[model samples]
Target: MAMLTIKDLNVYYGVIQAIKGISFEVNEGEVIALIGANGAGKTTILHTITGLITPKAGSIDFEGNDLVKIPAHKIVSLGMAHVPEGRRIFAELTVLENLKMGAYTRSDKKEMENTLEMIYKRFPRLKERKNQIAGTLSGGEQQMLAMGRALMSHPRIILMDEPSMGLSPLFVSEIFDIIREISESGTTVLLVEQNAKKALSIADRAYVLETGNIVLSGDAKELMNDDSVKKAYLGE
Candidate 1:
């Protein structure tokens, strides 16, 4: 079954439409990349899916539930987590505190502890800086913390926006590797990126959006090899 399904979604900022009735589905355990340039409504789509922006039309269904009507915090409790474009870690808080905030909706202490340990194991850098303020960490470390905090919620699907933005090439590769690892560990991922080549390389499937509409979509390898995609996004 598809993990998340969006049907004829139209999102508007007042009278100005940002998403023009786009639609897609994300299957369980898949890494689905939404690649487009800035202002193509990529981030808008993520925001709409996570209930941060109310859609002007259409439906958002996750795990077979109608998510369009749910509140943002309620949506998170229903197993979807969103890591927005910016690494929005709490700068003033300790790393541990930020992680704890992610689990605010959960009550299972044992499971929370297990998840925390898993996050620490996955990003040992976070463990080393557990007591340090988030603002003190380097960019790459802060990105790791953002991801780790999202994982603390034990979400079934994660929506990531421009996770590679502003990182060095090495860190960019590392971030994608971690995304793959996270997907393999049972969380489906829907990724939005301006770094089209890198996003398509790791994605199981990809969708190309232009001016808020889907212009192309297919298996990642096929999209990567497409002449137009190569010219436009791959710098060929």
Candidate 2:
């Protein structure tokens, strides 16, 4: 079964429409990338799915539940975790504290500790900086922390937006590698990214969005090879 599905979703911002009837699905254990240029409404789609923004019309179904009617905080408990666009970690909190916050919805203390250990094993840097203030970390480290924090929720599906937005090439590569590892480990991922080549490289499937609509979608390798996609997105 598809892990998450968005159907005929339309969203508006004030008088302007940001997303127009775009629909897609992320299947279990698949890495799905939504690639688009700035203002193409990729983040808008994610915000709607996470309940940060409500759609004017459509349905967001995840694991047989309608996300549109659920509260944002409740969405987390339903096993949909969102790693927002900006690496929005709690700036004042220590890395450990920030990670703990991610588990606020859970009452399973023992399981949360195990997840924390798993995260630390995945990114030892986070373990090294566990006591450091989140704001003091470098951009790359902050991004790592954000992903680590999201994983603390032990989510069934992870939604990431622009994870490589501001970082050195090395960090960007590292982040994508981690994403691949995360997917391989069986956590379904829905990625929104402007770094088309990198996103397409790791994606199982991809959808190209243009001006609030999906213009192309298929296997990642196929989209990577398309002439139009190459010129417009892959910088080929």
Candidate No. with top lDDT: 2
lDDT of each: 0.93, 0.94
The per-prediction CA RMSD against the true structure, in angstroms, equals: 0.8, 0.7
lDDT of each residue in 134-201, candidate 2, tens digit only: 99999999999999999999998999999999999999999999999999999999999999999999
Residue clash pairs of candidate 1: none
Give all TM-scores, in the order shown: 0.98, 0.99
66 in model 1: Cα distance from truth in Å? Answer: 1.3
Off by over 4 Å in 2: none
Provide the global lDDT of candidate 1 against the true structure: 0.93
